[model samples]
Target chain A: MDRFERQHILSGFGIESQQKLQNAKVLCIGAGGLGCPILLYLAAAGVGKIGIMDGDVISLSNLNRQVLFGENDLGKPKASVAADYLRNKYSDLEIVEIPEFITTANALEIMSDFDLIIDGTDNFSTRYLVNDGCFLLKKPLVFGAIYEHEGQILVFNSAKAGGTNYRDLYPNPPAATEIPNCNETGVLGVLPGMIGVMMATEVIKVLTGYAESLENKILFFNSLNYQTYTIDFNSNPELKKLIPDTFEAFRAKDYSLSCETIPSVDWDFALSQQNSDSIIVDIREASEMPKLEREEVLYLPMSKLLKESKSLLAAGEVYLFCQSGIRSLKAVTELQKVLPGKSIYSIKGGIAAFLSKQEESNTYGN
Target chain B: METKEQKISVRAFGMIAEKIGSAQIQLIGISTIDELRESLFDQFPDLKNMKFSIAINKQLASGNAPIPADSEIALLPPFSGG
Candidate 1:
């Protein structure tokens, strides 16, 4: 009875729904940043059964936001350590640890056992693998991601009412280099924690049948501005391409969407756009381009655009640039969806290419 | 002979970015994985022994790629957040 004491947070759902949560099984992918918070809250919430899977080991850097382990846990496989932490910390919760990396080869078998899966994985290759596996298994997915100061959360799987998955939003992935890692551009320590907590909140919402949860909608947040925005996305026509009847068919399909995407030209265009007064607005952080030697332009990071629409530059022919053009493309896509007919182009090579292009153009022009 | 101080960029991603001070650093050092790590740890003490991977020019590299002057080197940690 003491275990059920002030845990009245779930009491509002009535015991039946809470029992649903307790009986539910969730398989978490990745034991890193997002996984830590989701696991912590789910275990604390007394989810009857939890499954943890990851191939990576604990690193010294993970201690900051992972918040799951101390110095002693370093160098150990994340799945084992994370499961051990949850099992010991919340002795009441039942936990299973799959200490293997979830690859395309084993994704189906691994995800089939769980009622729901959380995509805590960091890279696109794994995200696609997780998405395809969940789609095949027809299990609901709780998704979350963090950038420097921004984050995203969505839930999907046709089984759950109002649940829409990752593919509904991004039909394809960006080229690996198009998007830099958090290492390339530092992320606020609390950004992923905030997003991870939001994801955990979504899991509770789905399990307890909170009708107003973020279903079929992508929630975006800017930590710097403390602003949040939600875009209603549905079963897109594009997602239909992901449906595969057999494993081989699935394997053949270009699940590596980022690799297959059209090579972008942000840098070439940004340089030209800026040199010719084409309204060069950097969709990345201003700090990112501290030494940026652009002539005439504007600077509005993606985080800024997420909350405040492009109403300011809702003018003619705006050129958006980011680190690798992916963010700008994403920003432009989101913006164009909302403010249709606005002219916007993504700078392909980001600043690097643009600088080179500028130099080339100047060399010839001179 | 003067050892040219190659200004290579080391990009830190995910949790690894947080440990290595700012996300991107144009580190000035003799281009080599060992020297790069040495210089990085020399500046950011907390990152010592922090397990992470390095990528050069967007391609994953062994820890021994010669860091040429003004090359792009990225530091990656296991990112669990999708």
Candidate 2:
């Protein structure tokens, strides 16, 4: 009776699968909710080498979902803490602690050594970076994400033939403002456990060739009702246009930039611009609600601005805004192409934040 | 002759589900992914500002594809949170 006796005696698993697991090298990014379970399972299963890459320190808030840490583990770097915990429990497991954020400068070097890459990150920029890097490095990517009560799991770049990548599903990154991570939306404590276990299962399936790979399909699970659905995806030719052709282009690309939101000026700064030579351009469509009544505001939709950007060349300083700051960020990106060195800013939170502040000020004044 | 309207069941996931206020909904008179998106945006304006993808009959679909009547549709947003 050995450590792997339970899994070894299972119907489809045996010493062969155990050996494969022992020889596999896996890297999990973002040692948070999903990472906790993934690292636990992979290390416990005797993965030859495991890498935990994360730059975040454990906080009290992570306890609900990130099960790897206890109260004493707080304030420690996630990668180091996760590595230390697993190393202590399983001395046979070799864990590499990468206690830094994955950026273009180091993503390729860090990820290239692993045979499989697990994406447990929380931000779109890192998600896209991991996806592209895995594609370039040709490593299998086990992807998992959670929001509120729901979770998504997918395996990308696994099969040699007819496999769909993340870009196939999301041709472009969503506006930063559009993405609401767990920090904002919050997550149920057990949701990541469910999804992370599934991700680990997929990793084993991929490594041992035991089950069919979730290469071209995505699984969506809802904990509220415990309902699960699988969605199939095709490799779109058009999506290739969105991916960079060369490593140089991929490295130079800015994943953080999105048309939906950009650097925005505060309400006070926008107010100051009212008396200055600065121009405020509203980029919302005509049908959109909550119009600003300021006399200095220019009512120009994004469609019109795209066609007639030359109209803005004469302005010394320009401010762009939309209903929720997403379109204005996009407008800033678009306008910068033509306006070059001209001063342009996207009003943060757009009219939504601005109007909320206005109502608050009125209530306080009374 | 007036064509019969198509009705599809839509499942919204992640933040898009929060914005729609329901995990499931019955969408009427929608024949294409593009049309369904327009209807969703019309009903939930905030959805237009968020990033999400549409899956018809459990298959990821481009906006121009024709969706079968009574097909399963899902609005999926990116979930990067671990």
Candidate 3:
């Protein structure tokens, strides 16, 4: 019996389907966390040709979940490390590396060559980029995300075989601040380890044409309870309408080219205005992260601001904020509906950039 | 049926902690902090955490934990996302 046949029978995804996996080409975006496991499983499963794209270097922080790297690999670009790691692990597999960030400028060019795409990005901007790019190209996207203990996965644009895309679930992109990254909160090392593995499973199934792919559905996993549930999705006309009739439009209306567009404030000007007369209102939720420090700051999670704001601030100048500065804008919009003349502006980049501006203090206790 | 502010304690983490100083916050609330916070989240729905855990009077509680005015509450961020 071959190593592939661990089961009693000759069943292993079989030989013909195996050949399809051996011949298929796949592209994986991001080479950290989820990307590492995703690439590892795919190569070992014998994906004939695989393109790994990333511009990020391995950080000391990445070692926790990106098991593919070692202490000596820190600071090296992830794409470089992952490519070499995959090749060494499976010398027979065709492992290729596009040593650059996937951006709107090159989404189509980079994705057009692959049979499938696995989005391992940690932020919404990148997820949106991958969603739009894959939709435009009509390629399959193997998407995964880990937030604390939970993870979500979706297979979009499945080989022109009538699969749904990202927009099927979220019809429109919410402001970026609404979703903070692991950096702002944090991820348990084991969390991504599990989610990323499941993602690789989906990819292998799609590659071998074995088992079933999660098409037009979003799968949710609760690592705590170890339960898996899925929500059905429809091909929303809102998204199908996104399919540009020509590659020119796909390239012209570029997305995914930028790794992240952080919302930033006019810090120099805003900080100057932080005085006794003005109150800087942090509109982020209690747990929504990247907490900044300042004296003039008023800690009112957006929830509180909307409720008793009138009583709390009978008369005052209020500036709103959240993680990315996006939510602050929304809060400002909402506040205007009630207190028409109240002054409110979102802190640019919310607290992320705020802390980035301030000298690095001790990282918050985990 | 309802009274004014009662003295209580609260806990927080992640960016929330980074914003508010680290310490068991001794404060006042009418009911429970969860109730207070949920009303906040209603206006700002994005903060809904699948893993938003809480502790009431030093014991972990669900989203529905009832607060009897000024009861201590802790807003915890997800622990597994590390």
lDDT of 2 by residue, A153-203 (tens): 999888742546799988778766455455446678899999999999999
lDDT of 2 at A162: 52
Clashing pairs in 2: A259-A330, A260-A326
What's the true lDDT of residue A100 in model 1?
66
lDDT of 1 at A144: 83
lDDT of 1 by residue, A148-263 (tens): 77676778883553435565555555445345555345665577788888988888887777656777765656687786655554575556576665777665654432433333
Interface RMSD of each: 11.2, 1.0, 9.4
**Residue runs of model 3 more than 4 Å from their true location after superposition:** A1-12, A159-163, A242-245, A254-366, B1-82
Tens digit per residue, CA lDDT, model 3, A161-268:
375776555544544434455654557778778888888888887776667787766666767768665555457565567555566765565331121433224566
lDDT of 1 by residue, B1-82 (tens): 2356556777665445667656567766556888888887888886774555565665545638776666777664433233
Model 2, first chain, TM-score of 0.72
Native contacts recovered, each model: 0.25, 0.93, 0.08
Error of 3 at A340 (Å): 19
Pick the winner on DockQ between candidates 1 and 3: 1
- Name the regions of candidate 2 deviating beyond 4 angstroms: A160-163, A259-261, A264-366
Q: How closely does chain A match the true chain A in each prediction, as TM-score? A: 0.68, 0.72, 0.69
Candidate 3 chain A: worst-modelled 10 consecutive residues by lDDT: A255-264
Please give the distance, in angstroms, between residue B6's alpha carbon in candidate 2 and its true position after superposition.
2.4
